[model samples]
Target chain A: MSEAARKGMKPKKNRAGLWGIYLALALIYIWAFSGMNLPEIKPTAGQITKSIFNGMFHPDWDYVSDPGGEDLLHGLLDTLAIAALGTFISAVLCVPFAFWAAANMSKGKAASGTGKFVLSFIRTFPELVMAIMFIKAVGPGSFAGVLALGLHSIGMLGKLFSEEVENMDLGPTEALMATGANRFQILWFAVIPQVITGFLSYTLYRFEINVRSAAVLGVIGAGGIGTPLIFALTSRDWNRVGIILLGIIVMVTVIDLISGYLRRKIV
Target chain B: MMNQPIKTSIPKPPSKIKNYVTLLLVLFLLWGSSIQTDSSLAELVAGFPNMMDLLNQMVPPNWGYFDNITDAMLETIRMAVIGTTFGAILAIPIALFSASNLIQNIWVFYPIRFILNLIRTVPDLLLASIFVAIFGLGSLPGILALMVFSIGLIAKLTYESIEAIDPGPLEAMEAVGANKIQLIVFGVIPQVAAHFISYVLYTFEINVRAAAVLGLVGAGGIGLFYNKTLGFLEYDKTSSIIIYTLVAVLAIDYISTKLREKLL
Candidate 1:
């Protein structure tokens, strides 16, 4: 029992090691916050209460029914269109690229690495940055926004697809290959069926994201509801800001719920 | 099994209902999208000249601007490192609570999950913009945004890993009458720490890319230079920024990928 007691309760000989880790983590945080000029965020209880109430009740619904509100609605519609198109485009492009990028399928280091690099290069640039670049090239408009969203979405979706492929059950793929099916046939019969659900799930998820991205494309003149939203904010039109926020929240929440349902069904 | 399949009826061509339905949907999607987007082949074709013009301007990147981008690039990487470190630290408690294995209570887990889900739905750009608006513009907002973004990402990843962890150690800890804190420290943390580190590094890589673009909204870092170059229509400078950012991202990615490979 004395030997067992000692065995159950190991002596803590290196408490300093744990403490050193904590100290290092602390130093990192302090260093990170070193140049942070944290402003006094004094949103008085009263201001918060007002904002909540204003957001809830005074949503400026009248603007939605106004003639000018038509413009906002159009912008919203445009954002949705862009996001949908972007997701669709990415779905079309990414599925094959993802397969090629998957290590299992390519079996060639060059193909997978090249595919991965292409995808990472796409992911490295935010949509806004992409839009700015494309806008400079193509001139400003929804076209630029669509292209940016599509390209970036390709990068993201391709990467996710590759990960899914990498993690997929190898048994089915091997079985298909053993049947002497060609690459395309094997992929179609084996790989695609297995990963289609995941593909759809990721695509829907990206659609949810593209909705938000499309909204902000306006900030960079990519042409969406964000243009007006930014304009409203700049003009200090809290009433309009309130409307935009409400609209955005509703759009986002609805999309989220739908996408969540779709994702659950797919997964 | 053979007898059951022998009774199969002759298969027809694609079901008219399904085929037509799909065809109609495709047509509708194309028509609706084209009209809604005001997109046309004519527009795409017309835009080529301008694209070429822009590309021509972008070529032969301004070698002189390379030096300025170095500092900006360094700042961006630093912002990502700081943000990711802070976020990774803060994620631990939230991830713990959200994990099904640790917190058997649905009440605590669900609420935290809902919050994380909501936070994740808010894209990094939107978060940065909101923070910039609230805090005024600079790297501070960028860093804060990255922190929040990293937290959302890492916590979600960690909890998923937590849910999938081996339960034997957890039961063993419980059998030993260890308290919740001790059980987690010894049982849960050991199993998940590597994965947690992997996620943090993954988030750091994302944050670097994210931070590079944060400056577009005046949140700070290389994105400011991006905005300026593009604003002045200095495509060469813009190209230089793009190239530099690409190199930095590629380097970070290569290192992180190598490290992550070893980690797991």
Candidate 2:
């Protein structure tokens, strides 16, 4: 122990690095603020703000549902559906990628390293960007959103799944090997069984995140509640916008709660 | 060959009923989702040729168009830097208040935590869209949106970590008759400083990604170019923008990750 601490007093802290940190921080702040013009409050900002608050307090209850057609309820359901399918597709597809990326599953670091690189590369593309790309291919609809989410989620899921594989107990693999089990057999019986629960929990976690993404995909015409939300935004229909925002918040919160509970149960 | 009973009986495996039920539910949800989204194999097949056409056009990215987006790309980084700094600054009080172990008042922490959670539910881009409505089309809305996003993320993580900080030091400080501020400065800050800094850095990384896409709603960033290129069917330019974004994001991620490892 330091002499000060040994004497029941405070030890002197190293402060040399603190000044450097402060200087760098100051420089960064200066650089950040130098580029842009100050923000202008829109002329209608006050009126719009008042209206938005009023609309939020008195949401258009009529927009909650319409007779057998698109409404808030359907919008929320479509968002949930997109999240569910996307999570499922990614969960199933990430398995092979996970196996490829897991260090224990590969013969050499090079193999797993390449797999890791690919996953990271995929991760850089936001699902929104992917949705745009898919809309070009599949047309602007909820299906495009699904494809985007499904594709984008593989990056995160593959990384998480691979880590789970790497952490799997090796005893069973060795025991099965001693019994003359084939490679696939060893993996199927030993690795798969151990990691399935972890994988499921991660998938549910991703599902929760996907719900938020799916809600906004409609802004670009990729489909879901976002489509209606964007329309409400453009039309300056404060009540409609308020209700859609409310729907999104409620849906996201509910899904997060359920998924979090399930994850806790699994893990 | 005979199916013979083992001399030493092994216990049967755990019930698979839960697994079976989960699998069934997943399958049903997938079926419903596909129908609801109008996703069909036939449509995918039909679209394959179009995708191939897009790929053919995208291979030769317009490297020359990089000049146009350079300013916007830098603006994106600037937005992230400012937003994350502002967020880290604001998160301190919120995090301190929400950390029940520190504040020791249910009434104080509970409402703060609830509002924090509510803020976290809205996506960053959605927040940007709202800010755009209020501030008009500019980087200000984007910066404000990212700042708000970073607040939710950083404060939540910071408070959680704060609650887990070592209590012995605080107790010692209390025994020394230190007041609340003194106790916090002498005890709490030292313990959580590294963690708080690391969380802020992590938020910066996420904000960079979010900021890049904020331009979609006229919030200002590289996302504005994404809309422009796509709207004009300039596939080549779109590819270049994507490439630039990827390189910038990856570079930042590498440096920030290294810094986090050192800090923590």
Candidate 3:
């Protein structure tokens, strides 16, 4: 039976198709490998690597607090604040976009399709780039980080919100319509009630992500732990870098756990 | 959507207190955050013209700048390809170990899963910056960072898929006195290979985007051009770099997404 199946015309064609894919993959890999220009080895590479590892093991605990507001604690606070405001801004801005992108809400596929396209276009721009743009506007600070994250979160949040809208129980909308409720009434009483929880849950999820992004926004002088982090790295302050990384890890982990629990309760 | 009992003369509405409290709390939180972050609407309004001026200068992207960036962009894609390849290779054993269904040992999977979660917590850019700090900058650091990120992402997705694979073939193989390695080869690999490939492609899509920005921390890519242009006040060139990155990211995303769709 195996020999007959293996020798079948369909099997033969399948094998040929698989080989073609393999051949193409091999060529692509070769091209990629050829383009690689590995950097020359720095003489101190091993020593630096060992020092970084050692720093991680013995992180400077003193950096955890300071009278000055520029310590790790304050940087984390600024990061959280930026993330919170950013999430709030996106949560508000995305509501209309969500309705626009929802296929069921729009009369025609073209309308919804364009909205989807616009959201994806927005999503393609990384938040870091947006931060730079905003820095040009606000002259660099936590404000720029907030604006950037707020703007960038819309892409993801809008898409998620639109899906929530599309997947909602239409029975409620239909029933509301039968009751002669206007669009606003239907939206407020029927659509809003169903989607509000999903929207809040998604915003929380985005907040967790924004925190991570915000942690690095400071690298560009947009203001966060990242600013100090870059400063430490440049000055070869490995222990400071260690503390910041640890703080980020802890903060992100805590945010994820809290948001996950809340989302579970919400959904 | 509202339903009422026909037998009841009148039904009292549920309390709106929770709704009011939640709204109030949200408003208070927003207020506090805005203050903490020094985010003022007035400042944003005042700065709007500056933003417009910057945007005005960015018009007419320097078409000539594309030639300079072509190599850097190609290098970014190469880094992503090699990184994802390495990650996928390394992820196989990690994914296999972490999949509780396959390993069947708390001691084996839990610590690995914990490490996986910790790795996932760090953003790719942060990883790149950290590597750059240690290695003192280069494309190698970017590649290493991407490899670490892909390991986290690919392993998590692969193990999840592995756990969800059809158990029938696994049980049959076991029933036939197949050893662990034989059971995996005859049963597990066949079912998971497609999903694993799909996940790897998905990771590649993300890696391209991350790799493009790695140079921000001096790890490598077209991102360094961003610094150069902005530092030089070459707004037109900066815009071109952004456009280049956008096109590259979109193209890779499109290809990998299509491939993943076909695979899965």
- DockQ for each model: 0.33, 0.70, 0.69
Tens-digit lDDT track for model 3 on A1-267? 698776774533577878999999999999998877657877888888888777788898999999976799999999999999999899999988988999999879999999999899889887888899899999889999999999999999999999999999999999999999998999899999999899989999999989989998998989878898889888888888788889999999999999899899998
Q: Which stretches of candidate 2 lie over 4 Å from their true place?
A: A1-19, B1-14
Q: Look at candidate 1 and give me any clashing residue pairs.
A: none
Per-residue lDDT of candidate 2, residues B8-69 (tens digit): 87778999998899779878888999999999879988998988898788889999999999
Instruction: Give lDDT tens digits, candidate 1, residues B120-201.
Output: 7566776677666656667878888999989889999999999999999889878989899998899889899999999998
TM agreement with the true structure for every prediction: 0.81, 0.95, 0.95
Alpha-carbon deviation at B140 in model 1, angstroms: 1.4
Query: Candidate 3 — which residues are off by over 4 angstroms?
Result: A1-13, B1-12
The DockQ leader among the candidates is 2
lDDT of 3 by residue, B1-264 (tens): 788657845667899999899889988988988988899999999999999999999999999989999999998899999999999899999999999999999999999999999999988888888788767778989999999999999999999999999999999888889999998898999999999899998899888988888898898888888889999999999889889989988988888888888887
Residue B217 lDDT in candidate 3? 89
Per-residue lDDT over A52-111 for candidate 1, one digit per residue giving the tens place of the 0 to 100 score = 346546766767755754565777788888888878888888877897888977869999
Task: Enumerate residue pairs that collide in model 3.
Answer: none
The DockQ score of candidate 1 comes to 0.33
The candidate, 1 or 2, that scores higher on lDDT is 2
Fraction of native contacts (fnat) of each candidate? 0.31, 0.67, 0.68
Model 3 C-alpha lDDT versus the unseen true structure: 0.90
Give TM-score values for chain A, per-prediction.
0.83, 0.94, 0.95
For residue A112, what is the lDDT in candidate 3?
A: 97
